[model samples]
Target: MENRRGYSVYQIALHWLIAVFVLFQLFFGESMTTVVDAVENGQPVSTTDQALGSAHYWAGLAILALVLLRLVLRLASGATASANRGPRWMQLAAHALHGLFYMLLLATPVAGLLAFYVGDPWGDIHSLAKPALIVLIAAHALAALYHQFWLRDGTLKRMLSPAG
Candidate 1:
């Protein structure tokens, strides 16, 4: 496969890094909610568990920062070849989905931070952001699957493995 124009090595690295962080955030988030519920129910909560939850929350914020950086890079670099070459409707859909992803990705963390500020008594209210993140993730995943399985347009390959 030929390397799609407009995606640099830095962009690729950023994409994969964000992917890992998002997935980790999802896993840690589900667990943290359980921990918070346990504590709320007057059950004993281990300090280690609390620490882990905090770690996940803070790490998610870090990922948010990276996402912002990636957005900047994407804006500066412009769209990939697949984006330019695709049908107008497909391109529009891709852009819309990507926009939604960015909006949710940014909003989720901010909501979590706000929830934390409101004094939820949990280590971090960021866990509350999980549902929103899950929704965005599902959309992102479904879009990818649709592109790969139904469209078969090589959009996923542009991110998964650039063509030489």
Candidate 2:
């Protein structure tokens, strides 16, 4: 892990791909729930919201595929051995949070699909995961900022720039 200091171009690309799509899904996915509630309440919902809801479904599936690809890349490319510069505790936390990210990224879509096809209970769990993921994302961003800005380290640059 100490020997490797940077990520390859493809690794950085996959990271950004998943990051962007997940954020997009977070922003748009809730509209689907709103539409569902409207329909359940026998209220007239607009076609746009309904369409957005459908888009959310497809977007979720896209996220699933991206996450899977990211995992495959992570495994095949030995991407995790970055020249991590931080306290041991922070490094461990980073790894743990990343592992959680993968789990939730994989599970959230299944929960969403199940909620869509099975019933509302799974939807409730998916709803709960949204906030948790949001928090994790916020923390992740802040950590990157901390490393780049405060610590004057190259952690953020590792993801943003290709390995030399």
Candidate 3:
């Protein structure tokens, strides 16, 4: 595979779109636990909880679909060619972090669906992924900032613009 200077336009869009949806889920999804508990306990659920839970569910499904589409586009286009310009260890770490992002991106929603929709015990997995996802996102954002400001490498610019 040939290394490109940056991701394709679609890849860049998917990256940011997923980021937005993930952030939405993180912040607005707290009501889902209340909604779930209420449903299970046969208690009266508030309309606000219902609306938020519904949004959370649909947003999760959207994230899953988007992730799948992004993965397909990535595989077909070979657009994931390393753009990192750093030490060998940094490159390896970047690759590992990207892999982990994909894994959690795929697994977290599936676990959520199974836990809530299918009544499986995977909620534990979904719960655990939240903190992990937040940490990884912070690291990813900080790395992009580092590349943009400290390294002056246009790494962050690549995602902000599709000129590459």
Candidate 4:
């Protein structure tokens, strides 16, 4: 792997952009579900519901695109994260968690798209993915805090600052 000194400006920008979109989705995602339920029940949908659902739909697409771009950049640039002094299992767990993050990131949006555009099992999957993602994100933040405070490592700093 071709390791760089630190994350590139584009990488950092994408990371933050994706984070914002993901948070938006997490908070406002219920709007989309509400709209879906209303449509299914043959109830009239309010303009606000329509608007929020539209926003959620577009945000999901944005996340999907941003994540794909980020993944490509990560692969093409081969910029590895900061190396920490940790046990082998800890490192493996981190890697596994990241891989799961990517998979869920990609799959969740696809499920949403299918649920909205198509319909059924996908909606259930999408619903399940939200809580799973929230858990993963919480764990990720906690791990970063652990590295920053407990380990006194530069892991969080590497993400915070584009330049080393």
TM-score of each: 0.74, 0.91, 0.93, 0.94
Give the per-residue lDDT of model 3 (tens digit) for 20-96.
Answer: 99999999777888888898899998899899999999999999999999989878877555555777898788879
Using TM-score, give the best candidate's number.
4
lDDT of 4 by residue, 1-164 (tens): 74787887888899889989999999989989999999899989889889988999999999999999999999998857556557879888988998998999999999998998888988998999878989999999999899888888778887878865
TM-score of 3: 0.93
Ranked candidates (lDDT, high to low): 4, 3, 2, 1
Strongest candidate by lDDT: 4
Better of 2 and 4 by TM-score: 4
lDDT of 2 by residue, 69-142 (tens): 87887777664563457788998898898899899999999999998888768989989878999899999999
Local distance difference test, per candidate?
A: 0.71, 0.84, 0.86, 0.88
State, as a TM-score between 0 and 1, how close model 2 is to the true structure: 0.91
Between the candidate structures 1 and 3, which one is better when assessed by TM-score?
3
| Residue pairs in clash, model 1 | 1-163, 1-164, 2-163, 3-163
Model 1 C-alpha lDDT per residue in residues 136-158, reported as the tens digit of each score: 67877887778777877665667
Model 2 — which ten-residue stretch has the worst lDDT?
76-85
Residue 109, candidate 2: C-alpha displacement in angstroms: 0.5
Position 89, candidate 2: lDDT: 93
Candidate 3: global Cα-lDDT? 0.86
Taking every candidate in turn, the Cα RMSD to the unseen true structure, in Å, is 4.4, 1.8, 1.4, 1.3
